[model samples]
Target: MRVKPLYFFTILLLFSSLNNAYAFCGFYVAKASSDLFNQSSQVVMVRDGSRNIVTMSSDFKGNVNEFAMVMPVPTVLKREQIHVTDNKIIEHLDSYSAPRLVEYFDENPCSPPVMYKMMPMAAPAMKSDSATVKKRARSLGVTIEAQYTVGEYDIMLLSAQQSGGLLTWLTEQGYKLPQGADAVVGSYLKQKMKFFVAKVNLKKFNQSGYTRLRPIQIAYDYSRFMLPIRLGTVNSQGQQELFIYALSRQGRIETTNYRTVKLPSEIEIPSYIKTQNKFADFYRDMFRTQVKKQNNKAVFLEYAWDMNWCDPCAADPLSNKELRELGVFWVNEASNKPQISQRRRPPQQGQNVYLSRLHVRYDRHNFPEDLLFQNTANRENFQGRYIIRHAWKGTEQCNAANQYFKSLTKRQNQRAKNLSNLTGWNINDIQKTMQIPQRSASSSNEDMWWKDLWSQ
Candidate 1:
């Protein structure tokens, strides 16, 4: 069977900035996206056993007619296996998984500790004249396995005996194959991989009345759980940012070929981040700093949680229907129905789904191979959670209040230091930005204690 190549779509570096909201736990500030870095791409992969569904969203800003994508497939996909889904699903997934900033306020130390519990949430139709093209392809050692029109895309499944023939054919088809792509194509050919090629059907796209191209979804069964990203790196872009959202039935998914490190989370950050839309910038800078600290050789786990519940939800979890729409085939609606009982219970929070979000800033040097993934039994929940503790500003005359006041300076200084360490920002600049008094360069412990006591 002929397969499509995985290089048809041009990677667009787009980022998303969400509006901030106040949740019961804290304020849900900005969330991070690929836009923080240039040349970013997002992929949502849903896997169960040997079956897999992959949805790819592109930020292509070029003309629709020039839009094309090539994907490597384990098997030739039938027309029914390919689909075009709404972009919102992927956006929702991004928002749900993106690193988030949550803000909290400290209660007055003088006040009684009231224990208040707060809970917070495709294929195109083949033409008869294509028979001549088949004969021509055979002469060139290429096979067109399948062809069909699905939604707004015309897709083809192709298999090649050699890289040269495939490259020649792709070039003739107006694909503008990247330089040095032949070697990579040959490697896939050696592995017996098939290529899936797709191009936008202009007539269909125009008639569909869609302003933007929807994400492309493909379903197949392949035991090798890996994503082919080598072709994307062939471009001269310095570094590409990729966000992979993996959903599995077992538990959290992680990269096996590369180190999968969790991003720093639940740490208190400076409160200035919440004053404006600086949360996204802070996240972006912190991520870059972390990546640099890792020497750009690791994949960062931004979020990994059971779909059932979130401590401080960035966005609501995907519903069963939405999960199914995203190619999560294992979610059975019947099994998810509420149980009728004498006492009505709150609806279920999460189903059997588990999501893992992996962020990587890769280049040809650091990530020389495509990503290989494994679903682990580890179900421990993790999120790129940053905290902002707003200091109590009320004046209450008490011994506790005096101690709280005395520690305020220390806390602010620590916050400044944390922000500096996280984002690689200058300590002086951070203190200036926070409008906190700068500490004397030569101040000693004795001087500081006296300053703290007398200043207050």
Candidate 2:
């Protein structure tokens, strides 16, 4: 474990406004993956009433022996309440919930237009410690409630009477905490929260033969539905990126403290974004623009839909078995909810698992409080989907074709403007890349009648 206050152990999108009337087919092309952000963490939270399961994964690129995490929890988790989960499941969920780029090809106007649509493809326990450790902990007003070596981690549940004592104890035990964490830890201590600390057991880690650390999951029945992110933000160099995948049996999850704003979605952008790394670049810059637009105080909702199916899926939905592993204990529960619509398939009943993806970019100055979440009754489906329309490339010479080409000019120019507005990219630059001339203030639809006469 890299002892520099395990930031890795911490559990922790803009919309475009070009609303075209064309039918949207979720055609998954590319996505802004979580790895794009260097200082980022991913957390999967499954909530049903007071029962909450939180799985935290970190991208810690450090020595395994130097890794450890100190988390604040409402209750002392037993050995059975903690376990290690496969990282792939979280990756799958990340890809599934990530903001994606979808494309639509324009139908040839000379021929009949068919509705082009694409369908989305779909723990152990531990024992007590030695007497010397107990005596030292008691002297520091800290109680070692429980200890267990679950999987490759040596876990400890602690209740501290004061932050000073806890900090000293942690220092003595080699769990290096970041500076300025004293106050935050003190606040949680005052709230009657218990500290769940874990460090890798080198023997077990070596025996397991895994190159990277698996995510640590904790399950407990508590009334508080909040995640302690303040601790993770302490001693930060700059704003940190956090992707929260919240799953609930009731409905979507929203932050109670901060504004939970849905990112601009289902909008159209320039077709050139489909080439090379433009989509990824477009997403990253667009997200940065939204962060600035919201002043970095808003939590962005990237995706919220029934997990039963996804149209233009970035990845297949997690199986019930995977859901169960991620702490959706009620995945097997029967429900009367109608199945979400899918292409060429009958609507079957759903698993009632509504997953919400929330992206937050924050720092100590902006986000002073840990994220508090609530499950709402709203089940409206939404996604951060950007569309790129490929104009008709045929050279047929009909009146319908002429009208289509005329409409294409306006569409292409509007898309350029949309891209500029969303990402703050220069309109002239976008048009240049699209190989179209910049639309001037005096430009009109009638003036562009012959723009696309022979080519796209």
Best by TM-score: 2
Mark the 10 consecutive residues where model 1 has the least summed lDDT. 22-31
- State in Å the error of residue 193, model 1: 1.1
| lDDT string, candidate 1, 182-242, tens digits | 8877887787777778888989999999988788888766666777767766654577677
Q: Which stretches of candidate 2 lie over 4 Å from their true place?
A: 1-38, 115-130, 333-346, 438-456
lDDT of 2 at 282: 79
User: Which 10-residue window of candidate 2 scores lowest in summed lDDT?
Assistant: 21-30
240-283 per-residue lDDT for model 2 (tens digits): 77778899887899988999999888888887776644766777
Could you estimate the TM-score for every candidate?
0.84, 0.84
| Predicted structure with the largest lDDT when compared to the true one | 2
